[model samples]
Target: MKLLMTTAVSALVVLGSTAAMADIKLGASLSASGPAAFLGDPEAKTIEMMVDQINEAGGINGEKIDLVLYDDGGDPNKARTFATRLVEDDEVVAIIGGSTTGTTMSILSVAEDAEVPFISLAGAIQIIDPVRRWVFKTPHTDRMACEKIFSDMQQKGITKIGMISGTDGFGASMQAQCKDVAPKYAIEILADETYGPQDADMTPQLTKIRNTDGVQAILNPGFGQGPAIVTRNKAQLGIDLPLYESHGVASDGFIKLAGAAAAEGVRLPGTALLVAAILPDSDPQKPVVTAYKAAYEAKYGETVSTFGGYAHDAVDLMTNAMKTGGSDPAAIRDALEATQGYVGTTGIYSFSPEDHLGLDLSAFKMLEIRDGGWTLID
Candidate 1:
């Protein structure tokens, strides 16, 4: 009888320890390989960095976070499959990442059906638009990006432009958004061109644009190497028109791939993280942005990308929600929706029931590449 009682006591202690040591599971899907590697690679590193920091800081409510990350290789099918596994098998409380717009869109149904709170790092509006009850996104939307660029164009009195976009889902979506919003800015699109994501050269498209009438600027909306291709070809073709790239190519990788001469004088809308050091002292975001840059650079020994900060914001959002929500999927969703005035590397985030992406047009800084670095176009 005494042995039986002792056994029960030992079992109780084991159970207690197990319960005390329980960790918060967060799942992520990033395209660490393939076409969108520039986006996903930084994102994956940022997520891991934030996770390590949080854990080192004694974690949230004494529960350390365990991130289950998968590389989707920029493939929609892989994103879908892993998203299913995250919800059904790993059973993460809240999920983050889907490296690009196309990959993120692929997992929306999986997250929605599973009733998990999904925070995508992609830069498309559709992920959160129409407000899927469980969906939220971290970056400025394609629509917001378009408005930011168009507003800048109006300020410069650039009334006409050429447009080239890849056939990828991200490119197509931005193409539609830019076209829809251009008229509102009183800027007319003069030439519309399309190219495949894998197409090696874009000289033909730039040639067509250079010959188009009244094309004051070139707006190319695409991600990965595609925009770099356009930039390189445009310079080679001696297309003297101002080149405006989408926020999709907001990484140093694009600049490196395109080379200094080709990428020089290129402009794009970006989160202030790219120019964190240049931000004025009074800017509210300077503190966090600078800290992130220092920490990221120290750890990775490479430049920080705005794409990385998308995942950083995701970690902050998840940890914030968990502070009040207690790791329950439903509670996290409610807490996430209630997020307000939380500043991170991307911008100030204040999510509401109607708007999942909290950033406005002000979140984008007009950035130009000069001397192989990003320069703030003040």
Candidate 2:
């Protein structure tokens, strides 16, 4: 955790390059040791690990990548400062970071002003929905997560559902998206509730949900400990309604935060990496997914989440763009837009100018907790 609070600047050189085209400078800003540490810690580790792997395999057309990384500590002000440093001082060609929605939004203007290609790891749709010319992201949009959850609810013939969300920027954004997209799937939002991110308990909200009529299921969309708190409260209240969580709680920390028994049978939208051990051998994503799982678990001694995989995809996508098109930021942006059929741990990515977050609804793996561990749902 020493690396989380400080900014470490180091060079990762692998091959020789001509004077005209020297090493490409890339940068990242992750929240390695703050409230969102669960998301940022693994992401920073993946980026560091992949850089070594890529450099060892002949370093992007014989030119090494000079990756300058910093930990924002989950602070928006720090994110803005680091974004500016990477572009103006370090003159990095591209940046990949801002681990949370709040932090990512803080740095958006800075990346745009410098015209450097930015691939954020934030979850909100507002990060790229307007389609900023120099910005792209790897995580599935909140809108997509909402649609994925609602579509599944419709299939089970469960139309009436209760909803709970945090008051934070990420939660509010996803809450609005869910409200707007629910009618399209013929799902009704029967009971609506909310709580703050730092709130310790959610029994009051669950009590409201328990008294609501025709509430066949419950949907809670928020990251951090919020969703886990809801799970604990629901179990304590003896509410038997099926609980659905957002992709936010896809990490093992959530399972630990809420006791295993309380999280049992709870369903959530996740990526293939969560069930990498059970994926079919013929699956194309299995190769990359399994490799990521093994490397991350071996190095960090912890389970890998889709949030970390998002950072992996961002690093590889930039590497591919530079290898094919060159180091120019514009060319990298164009190549990212042209990415098609790229097998990532999350899913197959296919980006276009109009669509920054490429994967479709199929990218999300429906998962349920059985016993005390993650169980893949067919």
Residue 343's C-alpha lDDT in candidate 2? 91
lDDT of 2 by residue, 1-378 (tens): 466434332221221122134388888999988888877888999999888888788788888877788999999999999998888767789999989988899888998998888999988888887989888889998888899888878888999999999987678888999999999999999999999999999999989988998899999988888999999999999999999999888877889989899999899999988888878898898999899999989988888888899999999888888888798988888888899988988888898889888889888988888877888775
Evaluated against the true structure, the overall lDDT of model 1 is 0.89
> Which runs in model 1 stand beyond 4 Å of their true positions?
1-21
Q: Which model scores highest in lDDT? A: 1
Residue 100 lDDT (model 1): 83
Q: What is the TM-score of each predicted model, taking all chains together? A: 0.89, 0.91
- Write out the backbone clash pairs for model 2: none
Model 1 pairs whose backbones collide: none
Q: Evaluate residue 215 in candidate 1 and report its C-alpha lDDT on the 0 to 100 scale.
A: 93
Cα lDDT of model 1 by residue, 1-378, tens digit: 999999998996675355333489899999999978878998999999999999999998899998888999999999999999788867788889888877888888999999999999887777887888999998888888889889888998999999999889789989999999888999999999999989999988889888988999999998878999999898888878889999888877888999988899999998888888778899898998899889999999999988888888889998999998988999999999999999988889999999898888778899999999989886
